[model samples]
Target: MRIQRIQAIAISLPLIKPVKMSFEEVRNAENVLARIETDNGITGWGEAASAPTMTGETQGSMVAAIRHLADKLEGLPADDIPAAMHRAGQYLYGNNSAKAAIEMALFDALGQARGKPVYELLGGAKRMRVPALRLIGTGSTAGDIAETQKRLAEGYVAIKIKVGVDTPEADAERARAVAASVKDDKVLICTDANQGWTPDEAIRFVKGIADTRIEFFEQPVAAHDVAGMARVAAASRVKIGVDEGLHSLDDLRHHHQLKAALGASLKTIKLGGLQAVHDAALLCEELVMKVNLACKIAEAGIASAGLMHLAAAIPSVDWGVSLSSPYLADDIVAEPIALSGGYINVPTGPGLGIRVDETKVRRYTREV
Candidate 1:
């Protein structure tokens, strides 16, 4: 099947509740929706949730890149996703969210055409369901502890604590508080600093929480300060992981060469889309390192479904993924993701396996 048309939809959907993170407070999901229609009359949907503080892209820039990329992808064969995406990279640089949206739509179309899920296209599903990580907000100690307690009760194997918004002492206290409350032997507690700390501050915080039994620390220093990250990894009480600091496979390779981090969290948008994420995860496995599948802060079903497929196929993703399903106000799909006991089942049908609702799309979509 050949690509016939591409449409970019900009949507701002309110969160179920505002989530204050280490970097910024997110009140809603600012996302760009990519709609691709093939000549064979197959339609596929994808979402790119723009996080200015994280991915450094905005809704306006994402939409612009989407339009330009759609025009560039107008006449390509749907199956040649890599080629299309590579051309898009040449057309525009660093609009990963836009490129990811376009690539996802192409994958959706390809999967639907082959009568398989997107994961099957990348690699066959390794499991039916994958466990998820509960990311607590950067709120008060009591509130954060309560949420952590609740998720632990829900049988989550992992939890992510948000830190670095306060003093190193305060952040260490917060981490210790959650660690003290979580008594599950199976639960692995982690922290995402969102690059909120300097190298020295990161060291101080990690040293302070050395007794908290943290499984890993994510993106402690600035995103580009790999040298600083290396310093933290060498001295940290726990493993040092990174998310925002590593974007593409090249970035992953660089980190490996430097041994900059213990592990990494790969998002579809950060890697250009489905294929790239799978490739990166496999590379991490070969390097004998942990990989985490993570989605944007607040996601619509399209993005979440895409994430589920990737998580399902990657057996190397041992730590568990962080998803925003429970935090979104509503989803654009008719059937939301299935979550039971902190485990998410990958979609079973063709393509992304979630039916997009035009009604919700129209309801949530707005001009940026």
Candidate 2:
């Protein structure tokens, strides 16, 4: 099948509740959706959340990027995803979030045409069902502890406590209380500072949590501060994982070299697309670094499904998979991807394995 048309739709979907992180509080999910039509009349969909703090792409920016690339990619063969993406890269630099949306649409269209799932196109499923990593940041120590207990009761195998919003000592106290709430010793516990701390502050936080069962700490300092990251990593017994700091395979290598982080939170918004994330995961495996596959703070079902496919095919989800569709009050899919007892089963159907609800999409659509 050949590409016929591509249109970018911008939407603002309501979140179930605001998610508090170190950088910003997310009240609503502002995202851009790419609708790609093949000559054979197959319609495929893709989405990306506008994460200015992470990818420097807003809803308007992603929409414009998709519009800029649409005509350039319109005549390319639908099945030749790599060629199409390479052409896009030649015409544009950065804009990984926008590229990810378009690349996801191409994969969906190709998978539909070939009657295969997106995971198969990547490689093959290493595992069918993946553990869902729950975020426990209710903005209070008691709230966090209660939330952690609730999530643990719901069967979440992994949990990430949000820190860096307050004093490192205060956040550490909250994390300890939260971690103590989880009675199951098998549960994975981690923390993400989201690049919100100084090296010394992060080191202090890790020191406070030294006796806690928190598995790893993520993005403790600024994204560009590899030296700061290295210092924090050295000061703490907890393994550091990079999030905002990682944008390419080279970033992974650099972090590995400096001992900045022992794991990374892989996101399409950071890496560009599924292929890029898959390649990064392969590299992580080779380096023996842990992997945390995730969507941005709030993405709809399309991006969430894309994550599921990646989660299915990636070599290891040692840090667990974080899906954001569950945070949305409404999703643009007929059946949204949700955690069943805190675990998400990968979509097994052709393409993205979810039906796009055009009506819902239109309802949520906003002028960009």
What local lDDT score does residue 219 receive in model 2, on the 0 to 100 scale?
97
Q: How would you encode candidate 2's per-residue C-alpha lDDT over 1-368 as one tens digit per residue?
A: 89999999999999999999997899999999999999999999988999998888889999999999999999889999999999999999999999999999999998998899999999999998988999988899988888888888888899999999999999998898888888889999999999989999999999999998889999999999999999999999889999999999999999999999999999998899999999999999999999999999789999999999999999999998999988889999999986888899999899998899999998999997
RMSD values for the candidates in order, in angstroms, are 1.1, 0.7
**Model 1 lDDT tens row, 1-368:** 88899999999888888887776899988889999999999998989889877677899989988887787889888888888888898889988888889888888889999999998997798888878888887488899999988887887888998888899899899889989998776788899899999999999998998887788999998889998998888788798888988888888877777878879999988887888888889889988779988888887889999999998888667767887867887888999897799888889899999899999999988987
Q: Which residues of candidate 1, in runs, are more than 4 Å off?
A: none
In terms of TM-score, how similar is model 1 to the real structure?
0.98
C-alpha RMSD (angstroms) for model 2: 0.7
Q: What is the C-alpha lDDT of each candidate?
A: 0.87, 0.93
Please tell me which predicted candidate would have the highest lDDT against the true structure: 2
Each candidate structure's TM-score, on Cα atoms with residue i matched to residue i, is: 0.98, 0.99
Candidate 2 Cα lDDT to native? 0.93
